[model samples]
Target: MRPQRRKTMGSMKKASVLLLLFLSLLLIASEEMVAVEGRTCESASSRFKGTCVRSSNCASVCQGEGFPDGRCEGLRRRCMCRKPC
Candidate 1:
């Protein structure tokens, strides 16, 4: 009986640890999504170049325009010029 109880407790502990790990992963994923949505750039020049901007002329085009925001950030991440928000 004692051995059986010990086994059950060990199994329960493993399950609890797995559950915590899963929850942590989920939280990290959600945080990444939020960062993606919140990130923004004013112009192509302000962009992170290869990291965000693709067009060589993007900076020239966006220079005079207002800074990009919200969905624009996502577009820039894809290496595309987006309208300012």
Candidate 2:
């Protein structure tokens, strides 16, 4: 009975160590992803016509203008294009 209890305790310790190792790996992976994420820069859309009303419309127009993303921003509601810098 004592030998069986010792075996169980040894397995439990191994399991706990494995769990900690897995969690540390996950944390490191998340940090790498965050580091890979870069800053985005924005500029006024050159091809967008008229006042920007909907962000979806602005995005489409900005795409046509060769930008990755767009949005209606600022007090004037101008279509602003965005791309990673």
Candidate 3:
């Protein structure tokens, strides 16, 4: 029983160490994924319903309008669709 307990403890320790190492590597890799700089073109959503209240909502409608990205902007709060050049 003592030998079996020691083996289980050792296995748990190894698993813990491996998991920590994996998480550390994942954190480092995720940090390397920041957005790249580029030129973007914008246009108002011609088919959007009502006013653009949220940028995310505007983006969703813009995607259906066949653009890559979108945002609510300016004094009128229009949905400005965006695409990279």
Candidate 4:
């Protein structure tokens, strides 16, 4: 009976250790995800001429204007440039 009790205690300790390890791994993964993600901000393109048409065209003009990307947005269909803020 005493030997069986000891075995159960040992198994419980191993289970606790595994649980702690899994929790720590999850915490580290979450922190890395948060670090990788960022808020994106947008502004109307200064160099884009006329009303926005194709998204590809807007993106090209925004690239020349030093932004990472762009899109035609809103009812006015303006070329909006975007980047991490």
Candidate 5:
């Protein structure tokens, strides 16, 4: 009976560890998806142009056109057009 109890405890521990790992992976995946979404929104050619453009204020010259915003204030700034929601 003692050995059986030990086996059960070990299995439980393994299950707990697996659950933690799964949760961690899920979190990481979610974060990555958010980042991708942000990048897509911030892209100049995004279908949604106003939303990304509103979040940042910078001046930029894109394809010979100039845009002024806070993002333009930063060095190495690039122009991105966002669509408003």
Candidate 6:
């Protein structure tokens, strides 16, 4: 937006520069989001018998399976183990 540069450049050049700057900003934002993301997954425990009713119970069994914590989910509410990737 310098006065001398503004007088020399046409409207199309200004619009192109603005569009390039906006795209660069979007690229930066997307990279930041991807870097902050974490991994999470669930798996049924073979040792955990029957239907899972409580998170506490699922957590205990998940710990036994070497996972840090777990929860009960799905329509049947099976024990789903979780761990960091």
Best by TM-score: 2
- Candidate number that wins on TM-score, 1 or 4: 4
| Candidate number that wins on TM-score, 1 or 2 | 2
Prediction-by-prediction clash tally: 1, 0, 0, 0, 18, 0
Candidate 4: pairs in clash: none
Q: Write the per-residue lDDT of candidate 3 for residues 1-85, one digit (tens) a residue.
A: 3789889999999999999999999998888666788999998898787888999999999999999889999988899999987
lDDT of 4 by residue, 1-85 (tens): 3789889999999999999999999998878443577899999999998999899999999999999899999999999999999
Q: What's the CA error at residue 44 for candidate 5, in Å? A: 20
Model 5 poorest 10 in a row by lDDT: 65-74
TM-score of each: 0.38, 0.59, 0.56, 0.57, 0.37, 0.55
Off by over 4 Å in 3: 1-36
| Poorest lDDT segment (10 consecutive residues) of candidate 4 | 29-38
Clashing residue pairs in candidate 2, if any? none
Off by over 4 Å in 1: 32-85
Q: What overall lDDT, based on C-alpha atoms, would model 2 receive against the true structure?
A: 0.93
lDDT of 6 by residue, 1-85 (tens): 5687666677769889999999999998878444665798777886888889999999999999999999999999899999877
Better of 2 and 3 by lDDT: 2
Which runs in model 5 stand beyond 4 Å of their true positions?
Answer: 32-85
TM-score of 1: 0.38
lDDT for each residue of candidate 5 in 1-85, tens digit (9 for 90 to 100): 3789889999999999999999999998878443334222233532222433433332232322322322321243344543222
Better of 1 and 6 by TM-score: 6
Give the CA lDDT, 0 to 100, for residue 54 in model 5. Answer: 34
